[model samples]
Target: MKRTTVIGFLGSTLDASKQDAARWNKWRPTVGLCMQPDLRVDRLVLLHGRQHEGLAKFVTQDIASVSPETAVEPHTINFDDAWDFEEVYTELLDFAERFEFEPETEDYLVHITTGTHVAQICLFLLTEARFIPGKLLQTQPKRGKPDAGGVWTVIDLDLSRYDSIAKRFAEGSRTSTSFLKGGIETRNAAFNAMIDEIEQVATRSSAPLLLMGPTGAGKSLLARRIYELKAEQHRLSGAFVEVNCATLKGDNAMSALFGHRKGAFTGAVAERAGLLRSADKGMLFLDEIGELGLDEQAMILRAVEDKRFLPVGSDKEVESDFQLIAGTNRDLVRAVAGGSFREDLFARLNLWTFNLPGLAERREDIEPNLDFELKRFAAAEDTRVTFNKEARARYLSFATSAEARWDGNFRDLSASITRMATLSPDGRIDRPAVEAEIVRLGNLWAVEPEQGTDALAEVLNADAIARIDPFDRKQLSEVIVACRRNPSLSATGRELFSVSRQQRTSTNDADRLRKYLARFDLTWSDVS
Candidate 1:
């Protein structure tokens, strides 16, 4: 059985009775605590000043007579005054530090009933802060019945069990979620729950967190909010550094992420402190992480594991202890299968992966977000703007309807609101403005075949673009565009070869599209 050890102050003032029998039998808290039937106090460390030596001895004798099993040890501690908060606290804290503890084989309790208010507070602080590995035990004497005895209770200082404390934590999480959503009162329970979890992780952990979602799903926004929250709480001291991996390319990517010495590369005129170093003791938000090359991924893995990495052209390794938050729209598991992303790196970051819902998945949030966007616009432009009753209802109706596909998610909504607010006469958005904005959004969302060709060409390498004949380029562009708009290969292929497929006896549209994509080693993951 584990031994119960009690550490407390000498009750010199409380147990100052002149009569021997009265001193022993009186309702002294420390002695009364030992009198409890169920509690077996194996040892007691009574702290006292030199003047209280006699008192300590008397108390020890009293305890020994009642409970002989308890080994009472009186410890001499110097103190000018028990009421001096700092002096008492420092001495007690030092005593706690120097005292040998066998926590694995013994349970410890700090008796708060015998000490002064200051001494009791200090003991409680020490225990609560984990400076002293023990729970608090308070003994209450029976009122008007000295012989009737008192009650003793053990207090575990875990704030999570308390309803008010838990509610406060929940409120903080809601505030953080609001910060991420640009002050929007988000009504979607699923999205709110996800944000709550993210806030918890952000507050408690420094682990690499992976945010997986569709484009414009608030990953970057949430990551920034997490950094801001940490900074606000003084948990982080360094600047928030962010980089979109999709925009990174070749030597520039390396030089940009890991610092480069002077003359590291052709145009390297001066030494540069990269994004990693800039984010030391802070946060690093890597957006569109799927776009990072395998070599960069390997370097990042090493950096994440051990806060050290070699610069672009330097042999010496630099250190950057940073918390990582990575965002990606790609299905990384599929990317791992396609041999594009590193499996080990994915495994490391996947530990804290959170999938954020796209706007279409949480359409209920659109109405509130609409108001949020207008407010944001008003703040930015220094002009108040509100939609008229009819106009507001109409916009919300269209936005929440099945026809309104929020392809760009919150980004599209913000832009739509900004345009309307800018064009609105005075501070009010009329019906005409709302109608025009809806048409504008509809036209923008409509995927034109020619526009898809432009987008595909933009992503393609110069060499790959040059290799394809003009005729094949036109066909490939249209096909790629179709693939992007449609979720499945069958849908895209049928649309692409509608005329040609009909001419054939039987059409294997998906197979045909797959073969065409194979010419460029492009898979569904690469296109969509």
Candidate 2:
């Protein structure tokens, strides 16, 4: 049984990609996001909304162009209707139960989604693993079919808006293809850092840098950004070698990083040049570097340090003079102390490390992020959309006030915005529509956020940390309900934040979550 990937492209977003923007095809974005080429891809699943039968067929036709035999599995939910997490999850699980996973399947399990809420959640719930560990993609659907072809108009989400918050989704957590929207100072600090690092690296050896951050942060995108920001003289011939550490942890890890000699292991009947060697004279990014086992880490250290790693079963060391930039959310410091991570190796790699911040920290940055999200989501929804000031204020108020924890960081925010924009009533995202989104976001963190409480007080009590982890999505949902019930000062951040005694009524659930993800090793994708 060949393992096949399930690429999910939901509703209007997919339709627009086909009829308008190339991303509407979904296949390109789905397949494109996957940095791995050896991974076998079997099915391209299209989860179309129920109302957009025309759009569903439209996607099906385009997918036929990509994969002729693949069928379009279209399902729908009223985007305009207010729905809870369970409602969506249950439907998704029940709906996907019919699709059985074959044992012999290999290569891919890509779930590129847009409209089918049920299918996307179903895939998340029913996947063999607790959480499907792979790249999550969102393509900006074209707003409309351009009168002329090849216009290639694409909108980007500016993630820098959040104060100190953009860091959480950077590097290791690089998932989305955009930046946060926010204040210029903090975002400028980040750009300065990138420029500084690039200058320093180019000056010396121009070795590849390893980025480390949690899941859903924009690691890959950052790598691309680094490439973009690099001086053309330095960037030329210095390609970016991006590889997910999770996917390459085991046998694949060895073969992928180091070229293997023929009969290297049971599966390797033939010789193959691994990614590390192929990446020579260029950059090699070991994404999710924390996921690598001690032995694997040692092998990576050798490759990065000495630029010589042994091919399995061959005493001869293969030379790979590429600079290494590894990213991971796991606490390598802990791994080193536990004897799982080599202290020497960790020190060698820790020459420069940057930690990213989650969205809530810079609640003030939400508006820009919201604006950026709207453009991106609208294009993906194939419907132009905007948020009324009242709607924007209502959304920001609740969102900043809530105890919502987005475990997936910016990725979660991107997904939420995309879903809401596609479903906004009358294609206008007013305060109510945005509030509906906040509710949907609240569903992710089960804690009820007490309104009108001190925001600083809430952080002091660590309410935000309690919002996401250890609690299942359902539990977080329940917690949100609880906060809603209490709506007290403790429910909000207290004076812990500032010495100024006078306080403001704090927001709820979402803020708490943003705090938690930023703390500890929450930035790691696989870190629980």
Candidate 3:
């Protein structure tokens, strides 16, 4: 049979007092606990401070006399001040760690009837957090009956039981998810559900989490948010170390991930602690993980499995107990099939893989994200910019249309907004500005046909395209490409004529661009 076990701090004053012969029939909490009929406490672990040594001994003896079947063990966990939250919590946490627990055969109870109110709170917190796997039992004195035993009731801290509390938690989770996404309001039910699950896993587990998505799909942002959330909960203590595996190459890849000893390479410089050591007790975000070589992948698997790795040019091994969140834009399963990436490594990180959809897949989200980007631009540039009502509608309509291929996802949206905000004549983005932005995006992402690989094919009539000479068409295409990529006329001109703009004292780059556009009967809206 599974036996019930009780753990509590000894009450120095309440459980220690001896009653007179006339009032000897009085009931104490510790003594009353043993007297319960239904509750059979097989063993009791009582924690006491040095000042309460005598009281603890008396309480144990009294418990023994009351319930001879129950085994009592006294543990000394001294606290400098019972009222200090940190000191009391630390001591109790240490005690919980040191105490042996047999969960298979023994059920646990934390008696909150004894010790200071602070200690009781700490025990409740720990129990609720599952740091101490037990239920809480508190004894309350019966009204106007001190001689009679108090009633004991089990406290259930499960939030699911309360509807209102559960709703509050849901609301709080939504708020937390919003905060993590940099205040971007997410309306997609599926995406929101994914974020909720991510938050739960981030707080409750330290296992390797994998975020899979296309480039500019916010994988890095989400990884950083997970780190921030863990740090806020005090679950992680070290710095967040991020590395783009694609940027690391050859010997440098190994040296970057695992520290190298001095004289490990040709340079023979000072020893270096790599990204893994830098992420000890924290989080490591390895973006573009599929780009790592097979040998490096093997080393990463070992580090994740054993928390130990041998740095380059060193016989000794170093350890770092870090939580991993790897980001990849590639289909890792295909890479594994092709033998480019290790299957074992894939299996290890596949436990919590999340696929983030590209912008084209979530077009319904573009409207809000557009506003989010504008707000971000305002904050970054320290200038407020708003679009006119008509301009906003026009832009949103074009953005949500099939012609608008958001190939770069959020990054594309961000760059587009930055351009419009920077070029807005006043605080407001007008219709012309919106039109210019649309044309710019079209030009930048436009795919030229094999027959007519020129700027004239996009915005001009066939007659105009036919009239343009090959050399002039090439020049116009170059000008249009530069203008599409740049935010302002001056910026585009500066890029097109870097040396000429520097030497010509009387020349105006913006005027030069305007005259060039005029030659083809084009305006800024035509080529932007």
Instruction: Give the whole-model CA lDDT for all candidates, comma-separated.
Output: 0.85, 0.55, 0.84
Best by lDDT: 1
In candidate 1, position 369 carries an lDDT of: 87
Cα lDDT tens digits, model 2, 130-208, are 2443333344333465321111111112346664568775652332212221212233345445545544554355554
Residue pairs in candidate 1 whose N, alpha carbon or C atoms collide under 3 angstroms: none
Per-model TM-score versus the true fold:
0.69, 0.48, 0.68
Q: Which portions of model 3 miss their true places by more than 4 Å?
A: 1-27, 34-110, 114-135, 140-153, 162-168, 447-528
Q: Lowest summed-lDDT stretch of 10 residues in model 1?
A: 449-458
Go through the candidates in order and give the C-alpha RMSD of each one to the true structure: 7.6, 28.2, 14.5
TM-score of 1: 0.69
Mind giving the per-residue lDDT tens digits that candidate 3 earns over 361-428? 67788888988988888889899999999999999899987667776778989899999999985889
Identify the leading candidate in terms of TM-score: 1
For candidate 2, give the lDDT: 0.55
lDDT of 3 at 3: 93
Alpha-carbon runs more than 4 Å astray in model 2: 1-210, 231-233, 236-238, 378-383, 447-528
